[model samples]
Target: MAALAPTAQAGQGDESRLPKAHSWRQWLDREAWRKAIIAIPYLWLLFFFIAPFLIVLAISAGTSQVGIPPVIWKDTFPFGTFDNYVFLTQDDIYWQGYLNSLRNAAISTFFALLIGYPMALGIARASSTWRNVLLLLVILPFWTSFLLRVYAWIGLLGNTSWFNRGLTSILATFFPFWVTGDHIQMMNTNFAVVLGIVYSYLPFMILPLYATLEKLDRTLDEAAMDLGSKPWEVFKDITLPLSLPGIIAGAMLVFIPATGEYVIPSLMGRGDSPMIGRVLADEFFQNRDWPVASAVAVALLAVLVIPIMIYNFFQAREARRGST
Candidate 1:
C-alpha cells in the first residue's frame, strides 16, 4: 500500500507539471517570428508611403526663395496664414482654371463610364478561353507608353493630317459649302481634350467594372427576366446595385488624376482653355512661384481625400455584408 501510494503521488506530480512544460524561451521565440512577419509590410509602407507624403506636406507648407535657395521653411509651421489659398481664390485666372478642370474631368469620367461598361460586360460574359484574350487586349494599351499614345492623338487631329483632310474633302464633295477648314478644326479644341481624356482613362473604368461584374451570378439576371423584368429594369435593380462599388472605384480612379492631368490638356486643348494643371506648371516653371505651386498641390489633395475615405468606408461595409 505504501509503495502504491508513492507511485500514485509521482503520477499526480507529472500530470500537474505537463501544462508548464512549454518554456518562456520557446514561447518568446515563436512570438518573435510571428511579429517579424507581421511587421515587415507595415515597416515598408511607413518608410516608403507615409514618409514621402509627409515630405510633400512639409514642402507644400513651406515658403520658396527663388534666387537664394529653392525652398526655405518658415519659422512658423503651415505659415499660420491662408496666403497660398488666398492668392488662389482672389485670382480670376486661377478660379477659371479650377472650374475648367472640374468640368473637363467630370465630362471625361462620364464618357469613360459610358464607353467602358458595355465592353466590360461583354468580356465578363465571354467564355473562359476568350475572356483571357479579351482582358489581354483591354490591357494591351497600357504596355505601350502613355505619352506615345497622346502624341498619336496629335497626328490624328492635326490640321493637315489624314483624318481632318479626309473629313473635309468628303464633306466638300458631298455637301459643298456645308463644311470648311475653319469649321473642321478639331485640333487644339476642348472637344479634343475631352476625347483624349476619355480614350486615355477608359481602361481604368473597364478593369474595375470587369472585376465586380465577372464575380456576379448570371442567374440573378436570368431570374429577373424570368419574373418579367425588362433588360433595363434588371440592370437598375440588380446589376447596378451590385456593381456600385466598382463604378465608384473606377470613377474615382479616373476623376482624381484627371483633375490634375497636364499632358492631355497641354497636347490637345487650346492655349486659351487654361486648366488648373497647366496653371500649376506655369506657376512652378514659367512664373517660378514654387510656394503657389505647392499650395495648389496641397489644395488638390485636400479636395480629393474626403470623398475617397467615404467611398472606402461604404465599400468595406458592403463587402462585409456580402461575406456574411
Candidate 2:
C-alpha cells in the first residue's frame, strides 16, 4: 500500500510538470515569431510615416513664438489661429505660388504621359532582348545623381551654351528677324522647368505603364480584329480602358511630387515664378513663421490626399465588382 501511494504521488508530480493550455509564455512563444514578421511594415509606418504626420499636424495647430521650437502649443480648440489659413487667401504670393505649382505639375504630367505611354507600349511589345535594352535606357538617368542631372541641364540651357548657339543659328536661317541674339534665352524659364521635370520623371510614368501593358492579353486585340474592328477602334475599346490604372498611378506619382517641387523650379524657373514648396521653405526658414508654414503644409496635404482618397474609393469599388 505504501509503494502504491509513492507511485501515485510521482505520477501526480509528472502531470504537474507538463505545460498548461492557459500558459501565456507558451502561447507567446508559438505566435511571437510569425506575428513579429507580419508586423514589421506596420511598425515601420507607425514610427516613421504616421508619427511624423501627427507631429506636423500638432505643430500646424500651434502658435509661432520666439523660441528654439518656434511653434507654441495651445490648450484650446481650433488650436492657435485660423489666421494662418486666412493669410493664405489674403496673400497674392501664396495664391500665385499654388497656382504656378499646379500649372507646372499638370503640364509636366501631361508631357510625361504623352511621351511615356508610347515608350511603354513599345517596350511591352518588343522582343525580350530589345525590351531589356529599352528598359535600361529608360532607367539610365537614375545612375547619375539627380542634382547633377539638373545641373547638367543648367549648362546645356545657359545663354552661352553650344546647344543654344546651335539652336539660335538654325532659327536665324529660317526666322532671321526673330533671332536677335547669339543664344536662345531658354534658361531660367517655365519651359526649362517643365523640360527638366519631364526628363526626370518620364521613367516613373513609363515603368508602371509598361507593367500594365505587358500583362495585357494580345489575344484580345486579335479577337477584336477578327470581329472586324479597326486598329484604332480596338485600341480605344481595349487598350485605353485596360491601361487606365497605370495611367492614374503614373500621373499621381508625377503630379504629387512635382506640385511640391522646389529644386527644379529654383534652378530652372524665373525668379518671379515661385512654387508652393519654395514658399513653404521661405515661411519656415526666412520668415520664421512655423504656424503659417505648418498650415501651408497641412493644406497641401489635404489637397493631395482628397484626390488620392477618391481614387482609392473608386478602385475599391471596382475591385469589389470584379470579385462579385
Candidate 3:
C-alpha cells in the first residue's frame, strides 16, 4: 500500500481488464438479441402446434350426452368416461377398418418403394440438367389440383374410358383369348385404391431416396467394383446398406399417413371398403359422435407414433454409430 505500482504495469492491467469487460458486455447484448429473435418462432410454434394438440386431447377425453354438448368437460377435468374407447373395441367395423387400412398402406408402400427406387437411382445417375428435368416432371403432377388428378384416375380406370377401352381393343386384335368382355371395370376396386395411393405418394419416396443417393460416395461403388464384385452384389453390399436410412425414411413417410388416408379410398373404393380415415370421418360428420371420432383419431395417432418413434430411434442409433 505504501509503494505505487509501475505506470506501464498499471496501464497493461487496465487495458486487459477494460477489453474483457467490454467484450463480455457486448456478448451479453448479442445473446439477449439472439434470444429475443428465437423467442418469436418458439412462441409461434407453442401457440399454433401445442395449443391445437392440447385442445384435441381435451376434446378426446370428453363425451357427448343425449341432450348436452358434443364435448363435455367440467372443472378442467374430463367428466366423461372411456365409453368411446370401449365402443371402439366392441365395434367390429372399427377393428376391421383399422386392419384394412394397415394392409392397404403396407401394400401401397411396397409398390411405391419398388417403383420409386429405380426412378430415384436413375435420377441420381443422370446429368444435372436431365436430373432437374426429370425431377420437374416428377413434381409437375402437384401443380395441378389433387382432386382433379384423382378424378382423372377415375376416368382412366372407368370401364368405358379410353385406357381400358384401348387395352381391350388392342388385346382383342392381337390375342383374343387374353382379352375379356366389352368392359373392364377397375373403378371401385382395391387395385384402384392402391394405384391412387402409390401414384400420390411415389414422389415423396423418390425425392428422399434421390437426395440421399446423390450425396453418397461414389468411391464406395468403385471400391466394390475393384474388389471384383458384380453390380448387383455391389449394390446389395455397399449401396443398399449406406442408403438404408433414406429407404426407411421414405417408407415411413408414405406408409404412416397412408394408413389414415381418406380421399383416395373414397374416390376409388366401394362404400363398404372401410379405411380408418373414412370411418373417422363418418363418425364425425355422419354419426355426429365427436368423442368417438376423437378416440379413433387418437388410436390412429398412437399406431403411427410407435412406428415413427422406432424409425427415429434407428436413425439416431445409426447417426451415433457413424459419429463414433
Candidate 4:
C-alpha cells in the first residue's frame, strides 16, 4: 500500500510539471519576438508623449503662485477654472499669436515647395554621382548647428552688413528712391523669420520630395513624352499627381514646426504680437503664469494634433475604400 501511495504521488507531480513545460514552450513562440519588436515604438511614444502630456495637463488645472515651480497642482479638475482658456478668448494677443503663426507657417511652406520641387526633380533626374553630390550639398547645412545658421542670416540681413549693402546697391538700380536706406529693412520683420524658417527647413522639404520623386517610374514619363506630350504637360499631369504625398509630407513638416517656432521669430520678427510659442514662453518665464502657459500649451497641442487626427481619419477612410 505504501509503495502504491509513493507511485501515485510521483504520477501527480509529473502531471503538474507538464502544464508548466507546455506554458514555457508557448511563451517561446515565434510571435513573441515580433510582439517585443513592435512594442518598442509604442513604449517610446507612451513614455515620451503620454506621460509628459498627463503631467502638463495636471499642472494646467492648477493656479499660479510665487513658488519655484510656479504652479499649484489641482486635484479638482485637470483644466483649472477654465479661466485661462477664457482669457485666451478675451485677449487679442493670443488670437494674434495663433493667426500670425499660422500665416507665417503657411507662407513659408508654400515658398519651400516652390523652391524645393525643382531641386528635388533635378536631383532625381541627375546621374548617380551628381545625385550624391547634390544630396550632400542639400544636407551640408546640417553639419553646422541650426542656431549658428540662423545667426548667420542675422549677420547677412543686418542693416550695416555687406550682404545687405550689396542688396541695396542692386535694388537701387531698379528702385533708387526706395533703396535710399543703407540696408534693406529685411531684418526685424516677418521676411527674416520666413527666410530663416525656409533656410532651416528647406532640407526637410527636399529630402522627402527627393525620396518620392526618385521612386517615380521613368517609363511613364517616357511614354507620355513619346505620345507628343510637352514637357510641361507631362509634368503637370503625371509628375504632380504622383508627388502629392511628398508635398503634403514636406508641408506638414515645415508648417508644424514653423507654427511652434520661437527662436527665428523672436530674434527677427516684430515683438508686439509674437507667435504662440513666444507667447507661451512669456507666460511661463516672464509673466510667471504657469496655469496660463499650460493652457496655451494644451491649446497649441490641440490645434496641431486635432487637424492631424482628422486628416489621418479621412485618409484612412480613403485608403480603405481604395483597398476595397
Candidate 5:
C-alpha cells in the first residue's frame, strides 16, 4: 500500500506538470507564429515602399538649393513650401508627360490583354505536360536581359533592318502604287514604346489569367454544355465572370509599372514626347531639380494609389461576401 501510494503521487505530479484546462498557452504560441508569418509582407511594404514614398514626399515639399544633393537642408522637420508643385503647374511639359504616360500605359495594357487572354486560355485548357511547356515558353523572354530584348527590337524596327525591308517588299508587292519607301520608319515612335511594353509585360497578364482560368470548375462548363449551351455562351457566362479578378490583377500589375517605365520610353521613345518617368529622370539628373522630380513622383503616386485603393475595397467586400 505504501509503494502504491508513492506511484499514485508520482502520477499526480506528472499530471500537474502537464497543461490544465487553460489550454490558451499553446493557442497563444500558435497564434503568435501565424501572426508573425502574416506580418512579414506588410513589414516589407512598409520599409521598402511606404518609407521611400514618404521620404520623397518630404523632399517634394522642400525647397531646391544649389548643393551636393541639390535639395534643401532641413534636418529638424520635413514641412516645407508647395512651390515645387506650383512650378509644375506653370509648365505644360509636366502635364503632357503625365498624359503621355497614361495614354501609352493604357494602350499597351489593352493590347496585352487582347493577346494574353487567348494564350492564357490555351495554356489553361492544355494537357498538364503541355501547360508547363507553354508557360515556360511564355516566360522565355524574361530569361534574357530586358535591355537586350528592347535593343533587339530597336534593330528589328530600324529603318533599314530586315524586318522593315521585308515589310516594305510585301507592301510594294500588294500595292505597288502606294509610294513605298526603301524601309518603313517605325523607330523613335510611341508605337515602339507600346510594342516594347506589351512584349515585356505580357507574361504578367498571362500568368494571372492562367491561374484563374485553370481553377474554374470544369463541371460548371460541362453542365452548361449538357443544357445545350454553346461554347461561346458558356465562356461568356461562366469563364469571363469567374476570371474578372485575374483580369483586374493583371491589368494593375502591367499598367502601374508601365505608366512609370523609364527604360523602354527612354530607349525607344522620341525626345520631344517624354513620359513621366523620363521627365523625372531629367529633372533629377540633368536639371538637378530634385524638388520638382519628387513632386512629380508624389503626384504620380497619388494618381495610381486611388485606383489601387478602390480595387482593394472591392476585393475586401467580395471576400466578406464569399466568407458569409
Candidate 6:
C-alpha cells in the first residue's frame, strides 16, 4: 500500500510536469512568433522599397544641379519644389517616352501571350516526366546571363550574321523584287526591340499560365465535352475563364518590367523611340538632370501602380467569392 501510494504521487507529479491547457499568455506567445514571421517581409519593404521610393519622391521635388547627387533639397518642410514634375508635361521628350514605353510594352506583352499560351498549355497537358523536361527547356536560357542573350540577338540581327543571311536568301528566292543587295535592317529598330522583349519575357508569361492550368480540374473539361460542346467551345467557356487569373498575372509580369526596360531598348531600339527607362538613364547619367529623372521615375511608378492596384482589388474579390 505504501509503495502504491508513492507510485500514485509520482504519477501525479509527472502529470503536473506535462503541459496544461494553454493559457492566454501561451496563446499570445504562440501568436507572437507568427507576428514576427509576418513582420519580416513588411519590415523589408519598409526599409528597402517604400523608403527608397519616398527618397526618390523627395528628390523629384528637388532642384537639379551640377553637383554630386545632383538634386538640391529645400530647407523647409515639403523639402523641394513642384517644378520638376511640371517639367515632365512641358517637355515633349519625357511625355513621348512614356507613350513609346506603353505602346512597346503592350505590343510585346500581346506577342508573349500569343507565343506563351500554347507552350504553357502544352506543358500542362504533357506527361509528368516530359512536363519537367519541357519546363527545364523553357527556363534553360535563364541559366545564361541576360546581357549575353541580348548581345547574341544583336549578333543574330547584324547585317552579315547567319540569321539575316538566311532570311535574305529566303526573301531573294521567294520575292526577288523585295530583296535588295543590302542586308535586312533588323538591328536598331522597333522590330528588334519587340523581339528582344518577347523572347526575354516569354518565360515569365509561361510559368504563371502553367501553374494555373495545371491546378485546373480537367474533369470540368471532360464533362463539357460529354455534354456535346465542341472542343473549341469547351476551351473558350471552361478553360479560358478559369485561366484568366494566370493570364492577367503573366501579362502584368511581362508588361510591368518591359515598360521600364532599359537594356533591351538601348541595345535594340532606335534613338528616336526611347522608352521611359532609357529616358530616366539619360537624364540621370548623361544630362545630369536628377530632378527630371526622379520625376519621370515617380510618374512611371504612378502609372504602373494604378493597374496593379486594380488587379489586386479584383483578385482579392475573386478570392473572397471563391472562399464563400
- Name the best candidate (by TM-score): 6
**Candidate 6: tens digits of C-alpha lDDT, residues 1-324:** 777887777878689765667787786779878999999999999999999999999888999877776778888887779998889999899899999899999999999999999899999999999999999999999999999999999999999998999999889888899897747999989889999999999999999999999999999999999999999999999999999989999999999999999999999998987999999999988999888889999999999999789979997999999999
lDDT of 5 at 9: 76
What would the per-residue lDDT of candidate 4 be over residues 106-219, giving only the tens digit for each residue? 899999999999999999999999999999999999999988888999999998999999999999989997778667889889898899999899999999999999999999
**Taking the tens digit of each residue's C-alpha lDDT, what string does model 2 give over 6-119?**
777777869877567776786688787788988999999999999998887777777789988887876767656677788788889888988888999999999999999999
lDDT of model number 4: 0.90
Candidate 4: stretches off by over 4 Å:
1-29, 73-79
| Candidate 1 clashing pairs, residues 3+ apart or interchain | none
Question: What TM-score against the true fold does each predicted structure earn?
Answer: 0.81, 0.86, 0.85, 0.89, 0.89, 0.90
Where is the poorest 10-residue window by lDDT in model 1? 74-83
**Of the candidates numbered 4 and 6, which has the greater TM-score value?**
6
Between candidates 1 and 4, the lDDT winner:
4
The local distance difference test score of model 1 is: 0.85
Report the lDDT of model 1 for residue 227: 98
lDDT of 3 by residue, 188-236 (tens): 8888888999999999999999999999899999999999999999999
Please say which candidate is ahead in lDDT: 4 or 6.
6
Clashes of each: 0, 0, 0, 1, 0, 0
Give the per-residue lDDT digits (tens) of candidate 1, residues 1-324.
Answer: 777987777888688754555677776779878989999999999999788777666666666776755667766644534576788888887878878888999999999999999899899989999999999998899999999999898888888788878888888888886875533788788888899999999999999999999999989999998999999999999998999878988998999889888999998997986888998899888977777787887777776787778878997998899999
lDDT of 5 by residue, 1-324 (tens): 777987777878588764566568776778778988999999999999999988998889887889866788556554587888998889999999999999999999999999999999999999999999999999999899999999999999999899989988899889989848788778989999999999999999999999999999999999988998899999998899999988988888899999999999999998899999999999999998888999999999888898789979998999999999
Question: Once superposed on the true structure, which residue ranges of model 2 sit more than 4 Å away at CA?
Answer: 1-34, 75-79, 176-180, 318-324
- Report residue 263 deviation for candidate 6 (angstroms): 0.4
